[model samples]
Target: MTLLGDLLADLDAEAAELRSVVAGLDADTWATPTPAPGWSIATQVAHLAWTDERAALAAAARTPAGREAWDAEVARALTDPASYVDDGAHELARLDPTELLAHWDAARAALGEALCAHPSSERMPWYGPPMTPASMATARLMETWAHGLDVHDALGARPAPTDRIRHVAHLGVRTRDHAFTVRGETPPAEPFRVQLEGPSGAMWTWGPADAAQRVSGPAYDFCLLSTQRAHRDDTALVATGPDAQRWLEIAQAFAGPPGPGREPAGCADARSPHG
Candidate 1:
């Protein structure tokens, strides 16, 4: 399989993992709140479905009869960057668990088809900068995993970590510049080396071997931190230089503004033993 094909498969696997948990939930359980403020498991799934729908729209816009919807998304994102996403999630969350799950399943399938049918050389429009097919697939996977964590936490369920998070860890390393850029700060000219041990204890490394600034630790911890699902204090990942340390402090794999990261232990719930 091609890189995009592999990424798409992993994306589907990640979604399936989340679906396995949510599928068993009754309507009342779907209403159970997650860690994210004002979002339930239903809301999380709703957000995923909406995002997937937009992803498909963006892909389809590369062809005829699709540009209008994609243009509207761009307009909404420009006019109300923050509230639009929350509003979509809130509105979709009103659906029953069954309907929401079915919607998510359908949306994701449509996203896959659109991505495959679209021209590979052409970048797709999005709320943020355009994305290549692989990046889009990885972003979707990263989101599915991150939101799955919220559902897991709400249900007190512990799902085992998998090597599929390498996509997220890769995005984390790739977005080091975007991290600083979002804060209106300049990204360092020199790259930082990152070495993470995967779920099965295999090491994954990126950047130059001799880079002065570096981050090293369990891929699980790095993934959590990159997604802003865990605070630096909560992760055992080590940063070797000021730049590397600062990157961990502000790392964000998803697009948009810097996120309000999880608070350290004592300030809030630890959401412990996530690895």
Candidate 2:
């Protein structure tokens, strides 16, 4: 399979897992608050559907006008800034739980088709910089996995970790410099080594074998850190150098403004599953 094909497959798998987790939810379960501040289980799925629809529209646009329309919508969303994601999610959440799930199913299917049709070398416009089809798909997978965790945690269930986390881990490593740039800091001139143990017991390493700075941890914790789902103090990840430690604090594999990450494990209302 092509790289893009592989990414799409992984995304489908992740989406499927999430669907299964939420398939039999009762009304009370759907209304349960998740780790995300002011977001319920239904809100989590609604946000995913909204994002998938937007990504599909972006991927399907093949003309300047088509792209411009999507860009205009994105600009409008930015105007609201704080409420962009929440507004869309709340609007969609107004639907019945079953309707919301159906919407997500259709949106995810359309997104997969759109991504498959787009040329691998072409860049698709996003909220931040344009991304290759592979990158977009990987981002979608990361979001699904992260949000799914919120749903699971809200239900007080812990799903077993899987090797699919390798994609998120790789994305985290690749976005090391972007993490620094977003915070108005310069990335270290020398690359930092990332050595993580995958769920399957395989070692996944990035950067040089003997770099001065290094990050070492379980792949699951790394993914949580990269997604800002877990605060550095809550994770078992170890950073050897100052740069590496700083990166841990601000790591974000997804695009957009820096997230207000959840507080460390037990401070007030800090409710992250990973925490």
Candidate 3:
């Protein structure tokens, strides 16, 4: 299989994992608040659905009319960058739970088809920088895992960490510069070693082994940190240098404004899920 095919397969499996958990949810359960402030389980799913649709549109913009539609989306996003995403999520979350799930199912399916049909050499336009199809698929997988973690937390499910997170882990490493750039800081001039222990007892690593700056930790914790799903203090990550230490405090794989990371696990208000 091509790299895009491999990534799409991984993305489908990741999305399915989250879907299985929510498939039988009651309306009230769907409305359950997640750790993200003011976002419900349904909202999380809606965001995913909306994003998939947008990504599909990007993939399909090969003609003049289609490119106009894509350009319009970019204009709209730039109009009120702060509220564009939240508004989409809020609008979609208003649907009946069944309808919402159906929409997400349809959207993700369309995304897969569109991406597969897209020319691999052409970049997919995005809220962030343009990305190759494989890069886009990796981003989708990362978000699915991250938002799924939010839902899992809301439901009190302690899912076992898996190798699927390797995609997210890789993004986390690749986005070290992005993490700094989003904060208006320059990325370090030198490479940093990242050595993570994945669930399958394999070490997933990146960067030069001899680099003085390094981050060493379990892959699971690093994913949570990268997504801002868990507070840095709550993770088992150890940073060897100041630059590496700062990266952990602001690591974010997703594109957008910086997120207000979760409170430390030991905080009084964090005693329960979604607290």
Candidate 4:
């Protein structure tokens, strides 16, 4: 399969896994607060629904008006950028739990179809830089997996790691420069080697094999760090050079503004091992 095909398949599988977790939840469980500050289980799914719908619309909009509409929507989102996601979730929360699930199911299906049908080379407008179909699909998979973590944590369940995380890990590695640029820092001219232990016990690598700088660890921890779901100090990932360390400190796999990463596992200072 092509890159786009692989990404699309991964997106669908991730979404299905998330849906299975939520499918059996009761109303009370749906309202349970997740690891994400101020977001409930329902809110997480709602946000995914909203994003998928927007992605589908963006892909379908080829005209000037259509593009302008998306731009306007993004501008509105930027107005209260911090609360933008929560606000959208609140709107969707007005619906019944089952209704929200149905909406997400439909939106996710539409997004998968729209993305598969789109030209792989044409860029689709997003809140950040425009993304090609492959990038968009990979982004969706990343989001799905990230939010899936929220849902699982809320339910006190630990989902098993899968090889699918290779996609997210790859994105994390590729976004090394974006992570720096977002923070107004200059990225290193020399690439850093990333050596991760994949789910199936395979080594996944990027950059030079014998580079001076290197990041080495379990792929799962790297994904969490890249997505800001886990603090750097909390993870087992090791950085061998200045650039590699800085990358771990501010790495981000998702688009848009830099995220306020999670507080250190249980400490006031993120740098402190313990509070």
lDDT of 4: 0.85
**Residue 221 displacement (Å), model 1:** 0.4
Candidate 2: 10-residue stretch with minimal lDDT:
266-275
Can you list the residue pairs that collide in candidate 3?
none
Per-residue lDDT over 98-193 for candidate 4, one digit per residue giving the tens place of the 0 to 100 score? 899899989988887878777889999887688888888888888889989878877988689999999999999999999999889999999899
**Model 1, 49-112: lDDT tens per residue?**
9889889989989656789878877887778775888888889999988899899999999999
Q: Order of candidates by lDDT, top first?
A: 3, 1, 2, 4
lDDT per residue (tens digit) for residues 47-120 in model 2: 99999999998997677887788878888887997778779988998888889999999999999998888998
Highest-lDDT candidate: 3
Higher-ranked by TM-score: 1 or 4: 1
Candidate 1 or 2, higher TM-score? Answer: 1
TM-score of each: 0.95, 0.93, 0.95, 0.91
Worst 10 residues of 4 by lDDT: 266-275
* Model 1 pairs in collision: none
